[model samples]
Target: MISGLDPSGGAGIQADIQAVTALGCHPMPVLSCLTVQDTRNVYNATATDPEIIRQQLECLAADSPIHAIKTGALGNAAVVDVLVEFLAAHPDIPLIADPVIKAAGGGDLADEALIARMKERLFRHAEIITPNGIELTLLGGDEDETRAAHNLLEAGCQSVLATGGHGEGEEIINTLYSHDQEPLYFYIERIGGEYHGTGCTLAASIAAGRASGLSARASIAQAQNYVLRAIRHALKVGNGQPVPDRGIPWET
Candidate 1:
């Protein structure tokens, strides 16, 4: 299930559904925030009522086995707490959370309270969290990404995969750190253009992989490979950013 919303279908739950469907998995969505946004940036976020959150989840549970869950943007602290409560109630489900702090066009989507809420509540429930370098620094403080992962693990998460998209280089490195093993580093040539819904795409792809019965590491590997291909075949949408041709065949 995806947590973020999109009016333009370029990001958030819409993009997540596209990615999940393309990867041959069923998508059940639960929105955390309904955002006014496009390829450019987010103007504002309106959170789903916390009380209604559990109702949607109950429906999702009744319908499917929901092999995996992917969350895109949790707009506020309250929504995050709701997520944590939901996870606590269903500890058996695996979750892939994309810790989105800022939009691609440089707009802040999460508030100050949002971060603290995640650490105190939601971080503990997630099976895997994907954060960018900026977020890593915020979560890690003075520690490195490796240290940050361990720190996050201490909070109760099983793994952390920090993405280095804002770095300067030809290659983009995404490092996965887990409590039970050494870090796994995956690399891909950085796609030069701005893209919409990439975080949603990657996280949903991971959920899809895991839903197909692949292990966590295997899911990350296949998801990484999938994102590279999606970027390579991306389509220019709107004036601001390229969106992956989510309809493209992602699995061979």
Candidate 2:
């Protein structure tokens, strides 16, 4: 299931839908927030009612057996609270969270209070959390990436995938950290030009892989390859940043 809905079809649940479908998984969308956005940036976002959120989740949970859950920009603390409680009741389902604190165009997505509560509650329930450099710093309240990842792991996430898109490097370095295993690094040549919604695509793809019964490690690897191909075929749909061509197949 997915929370955030993006009219742009560039990120949030829209992107999640495309990524999951591409990976041969059925998607069940549950909106926590709705946004007015294009390929450029988010103009405005409105939070869905917490009761409505619970209703949707309950309806889906009752009718269908959800394999995995992918969550994006939850609008406020109320939605976070509802989601946290719902996630707690379904502990075995893999949850992939893309910690979207800010948009690609530098728009503020979440407030300080929401972020804090998410770390305390939502993070503990996630199977794995995917955060870029800026988000990691904000969530961890520290500049050190390794330290921040460890902080998240200690907070309760089974694993953390710290993406390197915002970091300074000639080659992008994505790291996966788990409690009992050594850190695994995925190196990909940095694709030139800024693209929107890579994080959402990555997290959604990972969730899809997990839903298909792949282990976290295997899912991370598949997700990375999928995102890389999507980036390679990215489209300049609007005046601002290009969006990943999620409809394109990985092989072609």
Best by lDDT: 2
For model 2, how does the per-residue alpha-carbon lDDT over 1-252 read when each residue is reduced to its tens digit?
655777777788888888999988999888878888877778788888988998889888999998999989998888889888888888888899998988888777788887987898888888889999999877876789888888888877778899988766678899998898889998877887778889999999999999999998888888888998999988888788889989987541
lDDT of each: 0.81, 0.86
Off by over 4 Å in 2: none
What residue runs in model 1 are displaced by over 4 Å at the alpha carbon? none
Give the TM-scores of the predictions, in the order they appear.
0.93, 0.95
- What digit string (tens of lDDT, one per residue) describes model 1 on residues 183-237? 8888888978667887788888888888888888888888878888888888877
Candidate 2: 10-residue stretch with minimal lDDT: 1-10
Query: Which residue pairs show collisions in model 1?
Result: none
RMSD to true structure for each model, in Å: 1.7, 1.5
